[model samples]
Target: MTTASPRWFKSSYSGTTSNCVEVAINLVASHGTVPVRDSKVSDGPSFSVSASAFSSFVAGVKGGRLGV
Candidate 1:
């Protein structure tokens, strides 16, 4: 089963065609889990990650670990 309805928030820096995916804002502290999905596929498959893992992912993004 899927986690939840697909909702998204594009990065402010992303432009048209937005290669970056927008994350679901609904899965905040209450769930203690961060949910992420593709903006183009609203009802598509999504994955959930631990808050700490999510934090690390964000750090990697900022640190250029993912190479943008």
Candidate 2:
């Protein structure tokens, strides 16, 4: 089967810096997971996390629980 590619984007909170990761929100609905990768490494390895887990991680970051 042909797989769909994840559309990755950096977080809005990320300023002009290389220390940032890109996340593909599109995959959450179709794949039930979120693909993540380093913004500086476009051709590098990527990893996926469950949608719920990714959501929790984002919530923690927004709530300062992740200490981001």
Best by TM-score: 2
Candidate 2 wrong stretches, greater than 4 Å: none
Q: In model 2, which residue pairs have backbone atoms overlapping below 3 Å?
A: none
- Candidate 1 local lDDT, 1-68, one digit each (tens): 34565356788887787466777666665676777877787677788888788889989988999965
Could you tell me how far off, in angstroms, the CA of residue 45 lies in candidate 2 after the best superposition? Answer: 0.2
Judged by lDDT against the true structure, how good is candidate 2? Answer: 0.89
Q: TM-scores of all models?
A: 0.71, 0.87
lDDT of 2 by residue, 1-68 (tens): 43888899997778898799999998777889999999999899999999999989979978999755
Every candidate's lDDT:
0.74, 0.89
